[model samples]
Target: MTGGVRDKDRDAARDDTLRRFLLPIGAVIGLAIVVFGTAFLYDKNGAENLLAGIYQLLGNNAGATALRNGGGDQFVAKLVLAAMALLVGVGGVWLLYTGVSAVVGLLSLRKQQRIIPWVFVLPAITLLGIYLVYPTIATIYQSFTHGNNGAALANPLANYATLGTQDFPHVILNNVIWLVVATSGSVGLGLLIAGLVDRVKREALAKTFIFLPLAISLVGASVIWQFVYAYRPPGAPQYGLFNAIYTAAGGQPLDWVHTQPINTYLLIVIMVWLQTGFSMVILSAAIKGVSTEVVEAARLDGANERQLFFRVIVPMIKGSIITVATTVAIAVLKIFDIVYVMTGGRSGTDVIANRMYDEVFQFNQPGIGAALAVILLIAVLPVMYINLRNLRHQGVGA
Candidate 1:
């Protein structure tokens, strides 16, 4: 009787393990079949048919015009079908896994057991794998290849070559100039503005005026600058603000874009103007958080206004100051908007991101673009890591 009972218990344990594994797998496979059948039934005029219309609209650039109409549509349809099959198949698998996990969690709950919500987040995990991880891997892979395997594509290392050359090295330096001039100027000017408006009666009104530029988008700022740089024929009336001023002063109008280094700095000014308000607001809050009692004590100790501000107020608010600086620094590092909108990485203003864009899109060198992207990622990671660490140290927490 004892031997029989032990054998039965062992069999029961095996059954439980089998059930845990098989149900989820079966569920996913079933879901995939259903999804695939449904998609085939619904998508009659699939990717091929869509691409045929797009090709005609695109004019003569279609490489496989002979393969268009029925033939091209057929090929594209097969590709789409394959993709749909894959997604549906994986989704089904995940669905099954989720169902199984859910059942297990429910059973455990009945027995007064614990289940983490992280386990139930299978769907999010699947999406992250698809959208984030897959793209990053693909990008790295393509970046290793020499321009889509070097068949009828632009030079793979063209962008990097351009970037590495003396001329292109200047672009990196130009970006550095932008970072130093724009980020520091914005923050410093913002700090000054915050100090000025710290305790004024009409501080709100003053702040509103200073912060007005923050409302403008990078494109809008560029357009405004464009108008300022606008020129006309010598005999014609000047529509550009700067040109009009030049004519008024008996001087010739300048082509701003043609001017190196200076034009780049001018573009940086627009970013500084827009970003200063953001810096000011954060720093202003930090300033407000400084203890009033400390300021009073400093004054009592015969410290002058400037001494009290520098010696006492600054040290107390260092955390907030660092937060604002790091925020601006990150913004500076990722700044493609101003560069893209204003000059399109032209006239000695091309930065790493713009260079990457030129490589990937214009030159069709996806591999080099990926490499540059990785380089950029490496550059920003340190700054971001420190910033996050400081933020958490300030009691923001993990």
Candidate 2:
């Protein structure tokens, strides 16, 4: 009789605990549903980024300092819309903050107080808002402006008017060609070096030599390569490496940075030289991380060295290879220092970043620059997505 009474008491306690858990879970689910539905409605109208709002505020003129003539409807509508967005923008942020706070409390229940997690997270949150979020919002606002000089930005498609011209497509193709040829070549060489030095007795020494270029800042690397490609009109004692080689071969030293398509390739050489070391180091580390037991077992079999490397090693470190490749690709995509230092976006070496720089700094066109920056970000997004997916897969496997 006593044992039966104890069993009944335990069952009642379990039921009460389950009931308590379900109530909070249900409330959380309801809150999630509401938040998601609101987000869907807001995101549908291409309402992302602050540029559109700033454009609306400026009445379709870039930095006119006033609404364009007869742009009141646009302004009034935007101002009204801004007023409406307040509930979503500000209120949503507050709700998110509250939700995160509650989650922190839940997670830190074992600790002294739930507020400790917030204290730890506060620095990160502050940095994100200031460095990451604020800059992103500011960049968007800059996009709606006409120029740095605060000229009235009228919507004659001045930023995108380049699409109608031939050179615009050429700029795009030049950038594409750079991404493909330069990035692929660099990564390929890096892989070759990494594989060659993976098990070498002087692995550290090899890595140090390969990674030497990474120590140089982008500007410093560019300056060094500028000297390598430096031309002295064929009779200036052949100070540059290329010129010296040319003179040594009984040929006139060519002005490499001034030459057309050749200058593009020359700049590419600098990028490759600088980045090859980085790729080699990362890929070498990945290669070393391969299971030694598996490698030894493969060696004990009748597998030749070639078969062992490609058949066993490559497959295992495929994710690392891809990570390094895509990382180099993104680096090549954002390249500006070399072209900027060497030719200043001239001589047919205008990649997207350099072109964006030209648009904003030289041409004084902010909208076009913003558009270019947005496009660059879009271009790099795929590689970033691939990297994230690869990392998640690795984490799950581990």
Give the alpha-carbon lDDT of every model: 0.73, 0.74
- Which segments of candidate 2 are over 4 A away from where they belong? 1-114, 141-158, 163-166, 292-303, 384-398
lDDT of 2 by residue, 168-251 (tens): 677777778778887888888898888888757978897888789888888898889889878887567878998898889999
Clashing pairs in 2: 61-153, 62-153
- Spell out the clash pairs found in candidate 1: 28-92, 143-367
Taking the tens digit of each residue's C-alpha lDDT, what string does model 1 give over 66-184? Answer: 43545644666567667766656666556755565645643655442444455557668989999988987777565545554344336655545645765557766776787778888
| Model 2: per-residue Cα lDDT at residue 197 | 87
Q: lDDT of candidate 1?
A: 0.73
Per-residue error (Å), model 1, residue 75: 33
lDDT of model 2 at position 37: 43
How many pairs collide in each candidate, listed in order? 2, 2
How much does each candidate deviate from the true structure in C-alpha RMSD?
10.6, 15.0
Clash count for candidate 1 is: 2
Q: Which candidate comes out best when scored by TM-score?
A: 1
Backbone clash pairs in model 2 (N, Cα, C under 3 Å; residues 3+ apart or in different chains), count: 2
